[model samples]
Target: PSRTEGNTRLYTDEDLQRLEFILNLARDLGVNISGIAIILQMRERMEEMQRQIHDFVQYIQEEVLSRATAATDASRGAIVPVRRPMVTPASQNTRKK
Candidate 1:
């Protein structure tokens, strides 16, 4: 519930959703008010942690892309030779009969 200019209580969609969840918890799950509050708090914390993780991953991706672009630009027009591992044929003694 929020206070209007006239000091009347105004419930937003989020408020209504929270009220519904609380009602469901009490009626369906038989959870007490304290338990409901604790569950809500934990849910909020978990959501926040998830958001932080997503943001961190995005940051890492951006950093990696920027570094790769910088490296490509710096190495432009450079012919870098690729070296392959040398393979030697096995001797008759080492070969299976």
Candidate 2:
């Protein structure tokens, strides 16, 4: 109901908190405004990923920790990734078969 405003919905306190969180994240990461917009678009995706990580930790705790409790996972099941070459724009284009 922000009719006096020029075509922008006034954000509530909770919305401000969310926007603040996104802005803080962007600031901490040194991301640009456009990048921040992209991050906001994927905000729900980021939240989902965090939730999944929490669920996975709980699973590992119930299954692994219960069987053999440790100070931490340590070297029990660690993952190491290999580096890959950057994708060139020419290669990035998806071609139809």
Among all candidates shown, the one with the greatest lDDT: 1
TM-score of every model versus the real structure: 0.73, 0.36
Off by over 4 Å in 1: 79-97
Instruction: Give the alpha carbon lDDT tens digit for every residue of 25-71 in model 1.
Output: 99999999899989999989999999999999999999999999999
Report the C-alpha lDDT of model 2 over 1-97, residue by residue, as the tens digit.
2434478787778888987887787778788888777878798789899999999999987987666655455656777687999987755346643
Clashing pairs in 2: none
Output the worst ten-in-a-row residue range by lDDT, candidate 2. Answer: 88-97
Colliding pairs, model 1? none
Model 2, global lDDT = 0.77
- Clash number for each model: 0, 0
